[model samples]
Target: PPLFRRYQVNVLVDHSESKGAPVVYEDHPTYNNLIGRIEHIAQMGALVTDFNLIKPGALHRANGGYLILDARQLLLQPYAWDGLKRALRSREVRIESLSQVLSLVSTVSLEPEPIPLDVKVVLIGERLLYYLLYQLDPDFGELFKVEADFNEEIPRTPENNLLYARLIGTIARKEGLRPFDRGAVARVIEHSARMADDAEKLSIHLLSTADLLREADYWAGVAGNGVVTADDVQRAIDAQIHRADRLRELVQEEIKRGTILIDTTGERVGQVNGLSVIQLGNFAFGRPNRITARVRLGKGEVVDIEREVELGGPIHSKGVLILSGFLGARYAAERPLSLSASLVFEQSYSGVEGDSASLAELCALLSSLAEVPIRQSLAVTGSVNQHGEVQAIGGVNEKIEGFFDVCKTRGLTGEQGVIIPATNVQHLMLRQDVIEAVKAGQFHIYPVQTVDQGIELLTGIPAGERDEEGNFPEGSINQLVEARLIELAEKQRAFAAPRKEAGGEEEEIKEEEGGDERTE
Candidate 1:
């Protein structure tokens, strides 16, 4: 079919292709619909599953010009990849029956007849499909050399934000409601960032976005206002939360199990660990929190827990930065350090390694040994530096909200709060409802400029006065970990990544230009 001229841009934000078969029997009730559906499904050039129902050689007869194959489906089918490879290699196309699938030589021997095919093979799938083929298949470069990458989000700059604002306005007006305030538009963009993984494409999945839009409509109607204020956005969030039956149960369970700890009564010694995670969208990930590890001035400040625990993730890079920073700043004296230590989640996973948690971990460690109690109800999430400065962490909204949900479920004590990196304050787009809750003292969010500041905020204690020598009043977990980090840094030159400097060759990534896949 020719491309629809002047059609609005349609983004396909589907990832289901990585796992299962494409839905073939789509919605259709009328005879016209049935005919159209059948024809379209047939044009996919697939071997019909139920041969008894279809006419002989129907797919071959129909999709002669184009070939459509599900990447996963074809891969799962026995000998499918080989058969497709053979067809492309021979410059021929064949739709073999189940029985004829394995009869290789008799079907086509020694350069017999090449099925001349000007076929366009379309693999309806995820980017991973093509990526896997490029890596493992030697002859992949020869077949189906085309690619189509879709945008998952759009630019969130002021200009496009205004356009998005207009779209929101249109929705408001269509529902016979009021327009949105300018602040509301900015809030939406911030929410869009949280929705889209801060990507250029706002990835709050279409379904989620549609749901939000609908709820926004309801709020506007309820408020009896002509425009949707930031308040209405809050209302929609609260309404959505109220609908989450399972989440409600899970939070209660965590509370009953004492897994959701609250307000810091006081600080312990020698423990710290922190982690942060982002959701695909709203309440996607529960609020990110910190882990703490405490060391008694020795026993190695360098916690290569991942190497020990075999934890690996994309976020490890940030963790190393935090660890290294602590070592350089506190242990610069290269003093011999030996201190017993223990580090665990304030609220976390058994298998974890995401850099954002490093700050939390450091804080926990600092608080424990420093004997400074961290706030029990306050959860912190971010990455930190050796200099103790806070760095922006991803998924700030989801993380904050995640903790909020847990606290809410546990029966929000007035002290319930979330602590985030000072740098991440700009990213704050708490649901209008959540913001209101904060205002009502039902929840709280605190931003910290440094690990010290975060710790101070967490434990309700001033981070303690630094001495002339610049230490955490000695005997503190911060001082101990820093000392250990310095010792470890001196003893080992940590190889951060696979680079030539570390004796590893660089990986070359070749991206396809336009729709033409250039094989390397």
Candidate 2:
């Protein structure tokens, strides 16, 4: 009768103060935090527990509604994933002590009855993690049946542009920032396209767009304007770049001071400027690398020094091999390829990747073979195939601006320009300064479809096509290169002829000696 009078009851889930179903987001989904835990209290130097010490977990609180979690965090916690899966499978939450679950300690503990679960669970993560779980975890598909995919960018159609402008207005209002004028909206849309790195698409990365809007608002306030103007947005964008470009500035400084030798004028045989993009976190910038080639007479072997030294990635090595294929197919189809050439990225101490520099390397090799000088003022970026077709590369905008910055520092002559794949023409979202310079005839951007077009642009010589009889035009770059290859092949044959005759004479002397031995 006394124990019955002192009985206690614990309320784990209380919704008396709420009107709707509860929704919970568990930031840290540990084992005990996912499934309810029976907590113990230490009394008089001894551990003690009771029914009143029971604590409700996220599952209990979110019962009858919804629960959200970060997939990465759930996987990182010990037993958290298993506990969530167990609850989902059984449609109920069970509370148990950690020691009880592991059988580490079995003195005594209360096991609360399971609570019925009616909540829907949602996990947010990258596509990579989702794919990993779908492949590795058999239960993942059963639990997460529906999927929603979000695009990083949307097509930059006129209708979409209007919708994007409306989205910008919504963000401004929600953030309590100054309203953007029509010109300001247009500028923001242009910036979105730049962020997407496609002139025909706009980035939908809401966080970045929101940040830009907030920064523009701050600049607008500083300018004492009630509404954000295009000038303010431009200032904001410039300020953002200025903040993240310390490394880029240091690289440019090295080039400006001549510490890193990059030629911006004149011409040199077997040398061309190549562009590469360096991405650091949210900032990406391009720099020009001096790619040079040297050739001599030998059994045809085109060597990539970077690959030999283990400083080149597989893709870069593949590009070098492709160069050899192009040369053999174009110049040595009827004869043996007799040229030995080596390509290197001068002053490149770090690892090199990507096939974007293949076009530049090929051009440099052609220059060395033909003894033609390529203009140092021009840089090239693109991937080339065995057929000599130039393919588009990533980061075209950054590559162009990179060379333009270097040339601007050294005084841009009318001859300074960059040759890009003609297909990449649709991706040009250049900076205003560079665009102005192009309009003023101080700088240029040339898009080419084939290696011939690129080579002809790099060197002021014609890239002569093969006639029906398979002869290149005289004095043309191709003619020079083919003639050089033919000469090397002839020299190789001449050297082999003398060795063959000497071997024949030795064999005759051996035969005479053997005949004398037979007579004896």
Candidate 3:
């Protein structure tokens, strides 16, 4: 006894459910948006409502499924986060608009029955948002017991490379775009690694890669190619660079037009080029700044011009202070360091921050004191401690490439180079052309561990250490700095001696005058 000859099932995804998932991405997540709001109809100049007029919100529609919310958006809305928590905790959704909850509306509204909730709430946001919720909202921990952390990059292995090629193939087929050949896939993977800022890892930003693929496909079609080739991928990358590089070009233009004074072919005593990375939106580029130092006879202090005008950040100020400490410890242990050094980034009008230039600043200060010429063919980056040891810095690749580009513009003299901390060698994932230049002796990279090593490389002079009698070796850079500091101290003493003598004479004359007046 069959109940029916044929049976069929009809399943409909809520039209609002994006990407064919029962998940709701609450972009604005207002109280009325997260919970249902009651609609009203004006009849005879009065408000009226019915059960059919009740509109369901995200919570109602996402019942028995997953509800995705951006924690930042949810918190930005007034009472929306708390309302969502209440629903999740109570396992029921009460349709209450913000006006009703705040008692702002005087007109009558329908009170829809609460719908039982049985759905998983997933919050997608930064780590700061999650930490804030855990610290501020007690129920957040109880509700979100499970956490899924995503890595920014994945390891670049043969297996992963094959998988990534397959992913690109699938995307190309799905989007009805020209297929990418092996060379194009390889180039894209290399670009992905560059995006991650690591040679060993590939970026997980699939959307960005997909966009690149589509653009490459368009260029391939324009060139009348049947498939996307490596040249197409390279052109797409070049176009992206051309589009987002206006500011970089302007900076380079300023450098070339003599608006920003950076020498690429000579040597100066108290100047060195320092590297810094500027982030504009999602694009970041590095530029070299001319850091100069002037030293004179005064109390031992390193005056940071950027900090004086409030352009330098706390870390930069700290680095300058550490420069003072290093001078005191290394050169002034026995004699008073009667030197005042002023450091400035020449021609920089905007706010300058970061301690990555500390090494360059110290090199400039030392050059000013020792009167040793630092090669303009070279630029330097890294932070230095009180012990004068070079420390690693961020954006090693960008910093190196920045100076390289500036030098390349002026023509690579085969002697141009950049000195970086030795520890940062592992982080080197430079461009192929730069690598070729290095290999062909058109450019160079010097890795230094201590201030001694860096100073030697910068000035082509040895930074001699103290002997058994605490005296620097004859004719060394350190000896010259020490001798200069001694001369300044002697000059300071001579100047103060005359001032003290004049003051004593005035006191004696005042006493004699008082005695003569009393006698009269």
Candidate whose TM-score is highest: 2
Q: How many residue pairs clash per model?
A: 59, 0, 0
Q: TM-score for all predictions?
A: 0.60, 0.95, 0.89
> What is the alpha-carbon RMSD of candidate 3 to the true structure?
5.2
Model 1 misplacement above 4 A: 1-69, 94-98, 104-115, 158-193, 197-201, 207-248, 256-260, 264-283, 287-294, 297-325, 346-349, 385-389, 405-416, 439-444, 459-520
Give the C-alpha miss distance for residue 301 in model 3, angstroms.
1.0
Return the number of clashes found in candidate 1: 59
Q: Global lDDT of each model?
A: 0.57, 0.94, 0.88
lDDT of 1: 0.57
Sort order, TM-score high to low: 2, 3, 1
Residues 257-295 of candidate 3 have per-residue lDDT tens digits of: 888888887899999988899888877788999999999
Clashing pairs in 2: none
Error of 3 at 108 (Å): 3.6
Q: Worst ten-residue run, lDDT, model 3?
A: 4-13
User: Please, what are the lDDT tens digits per residue for candidate 2 over residues 1-520?
Assistant: 5265338667888899978988899999998888978777787999877787889999998999989999999999988998899889999888876677778986867877888889999999899999999999999999889998889999999999999999999999999999999999999999999999999999999999999999999999999999999999999999999999999999999999999889989899999999999998998999999999999988899999999999999999999999999999999998999989999999999999999999999999999999999999999999999999999999999999999999999898899999999999999999999999999999999999999999999998999998998888999999999999999999999999999999999999999999999999
Residue 379 lDDT in model 3? 93
CA displacement after TM-score superposition, residue 192 of candidate 2 (Å): 0.9
Which of the predicted structures, 1 or 2, would earn the higher TM-score when compared with the native? 2
Which residue pairs clash in candidate 3? none
Q: Residue 134: error of model 2 in Å?
A: 2.5
lDDT digits (tens) for residues 70-176 of candidate 1: 77766765655676566556655454433444464353312222235444566676888889988888787667676788766776676777777777777656756
